[model samples]
Target: MKYVEKAPHVDPVRMRHITDEALLAELGVTSIAEARPWRRPDPAWDGPATIEEADALIGAEVDFLDKGRGRSRLYGFHYLRWMTPLVHAYRETGDARYAAEWDRLFRQWYGTRDQVEGDWPGLDVIWYSLGVWARSMHVTRAMAELADEPALSDECWAMMMKTVLGGARWSAEEHDEFRHGNWQFVCAAELLHVATLFPELPEAPRWAEIGRARVLEHLELDVRADGGHHERSPGYHGMVLDAVHRVLALDPSFAEHPRVRAMHSWFASLVTSGGWIPHLQDSGVVWPAGALRRGAELGVRPEPGSHLLDASGYAIFRAGHLHTVINYGPYVGHELEPHSHHAALDFVLSGWGVPLAWEAGGPPSYDDPGYYDWYQATRGHNTILVPGEEYTEDRKAGLDLFHAGQHVDVFAGHHHGYSARHDRRIVFVRDEPSYWLVTDSIDADAVWQVHGLAPWKPHGSGYVTKNLLVVPLEAPDEVLHGNGPARIPDPATGTAEYGEIHSLGLRRADGRFTVALVPFTDDPPAVHLATVPPLASPQETSVPDHLRVAIGGIVDTVSASTWARADVREGWAADG
Candidate 1:
């Protein structure tokens, strides 16, 4: 394929289906006959067609600052999902009217885009505009079939050249670290697509070369040795991976790259049997099944059954139809805000395609107080929480055991969050009625009071003991919400919304607790809690002056050790 004339590697058949669906949604029409609701040549209707019933189809302004982050007042115009329908209608149906509408929309956008730039505040705001420009220009250039008229074709070409020059200049001037990781990927991929699509332009070759190099370099750096993105957020990991996939689609040579395949492999293995990826860091709850399928097509396959990502400190244990994920790794620190969470050595369980215990749902909006209070807090995860303390981004983690052979998988690590040393061990036995055991040892001076926070949907049931606080998770309105003094600007509202939950809390310092989790494909399993006597004296411990002062009482001399074992009963008859 000639690089200059090449377009996005979209499959015509699949694109047609996707376009058809988009058209139906945009126009609110049931059939092709109803697709063109507006007059065939409504010159005033310059933007994409909107449903007749919709009052607010598209916003007029190109850059309304109030929407926040990458969002624009004109959401549809920025996303331009409506392009497929416009291009498809014009190309397949031979409708000059559709072409005219496309022309009008292009001119309207071009005019607004120019005005918005003069109004931008600073260099930071430029990123949002850059993203908008990239997406708009990409759509316009790729849909070559829509520009049928000579005048429209010439105007489109002029915009293309302008876009290429401006984008290329930005790429050359901007340091790699300035717009690093996801930003680098976005800019490079856009430039690559533009330069490749229009190589006839004088700057095409240079821009394309630069774009290729930057993308490949970041692709290596952004993804860690364990195959996870350095951002440490599973949400951004999938997003960045999807962007890489698009680049690979345009140029297939990169598919064979080891780093690329490792990325795909990581994603494929990251998903729980419940069809949900671990909500690690700032990642969302939605699964990326399509990305996984594409990864497989690109020869990036998951481990045979179970495996561990040592560098990223994630371990996956799979037995029969059940799947579980354990995180016992260091905090991944990025140059900027890493979005790392305090749920170190936390684990999530699932069976078949149902989530038994979920990570906190995605953060709904960055502006909401609940974002920091609950969604991003240690209490939001399935891990131990210090009563009056918070987790910090300290890389205090070490692996104790990692063996996934002989029908047994064991993984253990220690992390220091809340100023306490936490040693956690997980043992997955793949015997009849497969079950997993979680052992947590929190060592802290008497000054601090620790609580084990086992979170699940409100529907689940559990008991609360003197060492445990079992109650339905309350909303931010009900629970105390605290945030750090320093605040950062978050762009988009994440998908996670807070809801009531069932929280299993343990308030015991310098203690070890064991719980067996057995996931069921259908209904919630039956759980029984039992006390296990210590086989040996607990490990040596000491109290600090600060802890003694904080506790304001005599430190318990007995150094008592209490272990509770919860046995789960799931109907895995065949396995048993």
Candidate 2:
């Protein structure tokens, strides 16, 4: 076999920095001798395999995509892709144990007609196979010692060719690189890596052209000009950025591409000072520290704007001590992408680096039956929920009004989450201290059951009045505990303190509901609110939609003493 020369710029040290450590840790082995016996202990592994029976063909008949059987089979696939760390460990330790185990595992997985020729089953299997091939290529090309092992080297070459050809063929037939978002990114990136590793192959140049074109196409479509991904999920945005970074490591030509730079910039902008991005869709609350470090090393600049990602449909507005995210983008979920939520035009609020109001989280898994029905429903968000109606992604949410000025910040949009056209208007004043006033108007023939939810942490003495919910921010810990969608401290073990999120709600059958959020502190300049009555005539006064009067002096007409809902509502956060 003719040994192809590697790209001079392709260095393993650079690739190792961006590698998926969480995934590698999933298949950790205490010793190289145990590598063959370290198959993931999944019941789907042909009804479970003891250590002695590790190499047995237990997964021959299992449908790996079936939910009940998926996790187990998925774990087995992780073991197959463990070539990444195995090679890394071998290089670091200079141990023959690693090489012998790698040879054994490769033979067990690929030596026979039944093992290699069996049905590849699903896209996930193909995806995992591509991952294995890429890692194996990296090992062979970078470590000449591994490639010079005569017999083992020949076997590696055969296996690499088999997997790459199969993956390329499957990719061309099964996926349209231009259409599938994240999947194509992975496939194309791997193809490019393979092409760079082996220039002597007949299919090398074609792979290079197609892979480069496909990846650039994804960057054009999925990444918006404003430096946000079209999916509008912070997690996926990070995932795509990492993929691009890996490919750029192999081909330095893409390093300075405008789209590539913009993607990284978007990632840097999404992160908060606390090192977390608001969990949207499948994204977790905290961005990976390693990815952030790599992004910084790559010189990803956070673009300056009003925190508005117009193309992707979100704006993070900041004021004195407030950081608010408003979702006013198109339907993020589509036929090929359904990972986003029915959270159009909804707003998430945080104050002084602490979350104040957010969602309570949805179904844990995508394949879970309740995912589309319940968690993705409108009721799962911190927005108005119409009874018996679910928001569908078919109807887009468009922003009808927007203004950001020195005195006020306002946004209005309509969503077809129900039979009625739900028009919501939100405005924040730049008073000494700030508060938000939200007005929701519905237009329909039939009477509707409407309510607004403000899921906040019960930090201090607070209550849910008829048209208002007040939560006092006495300390920062209360605000920290309020971060949601992705649990902060995590909810499962109860060991962490920041994951719990509580709800504050209002219910009214009327077509219009005006609500106010008032903030209280131990110091002066306390936040207060009042409902401004409809004027008898239109005038040129710049009076806000509702009133936010700092409580020190003046008539105080809309005082807390005169609140209409003296009788607190049921299930109020403070009462709970």
Per-residue lDDT for 328-431 in model 1, tens only?
A: 77666544345666667777666555445555644544444666666667776777666667577784777766667554566767777767687766666565
Residue pairs with colliding backbones in model 1 are 235-283, 274-353, 362-496, 432-575, 433-576, 447-547, 452-506, 473-501
Steric clashes per prediction: 8, 1
User: Considering every candidate listed, which one attains the maximal lDDT?
Assistant: 1
Tell me the whole-model lDDT of each prediction, alpha carbons only.
0.51, 0.50
Using TM-score as the measure, the top candidate is 1
Give model 1 RMSD, 1 decimal.
12.2
- lDDT by residue for model 2 (1-576), tens: 111112122122111111244422321211111011111211111121233332232233323233343432343453354344444445456655555566655655554312221133443433443344344334344234344333344345445434445555445444444764565666676666666655644556777777788888887776788767667777667656666765767766786777777766666555554455667665556444555565566676665434566777776666665656788776655444366787667776655444555554434445455565545666556676565665667657887666564545666777786777777766654443456666666653212111223343332243432223453211111111122233442323322232444444444444454444654344323344443554343232213333333344421222111211223211101100
Model 1 bad stretches (over 4 Å): 1-123, 128-142, 149-161, 175-180, 334-336, 445-501, 509-511, 521-576
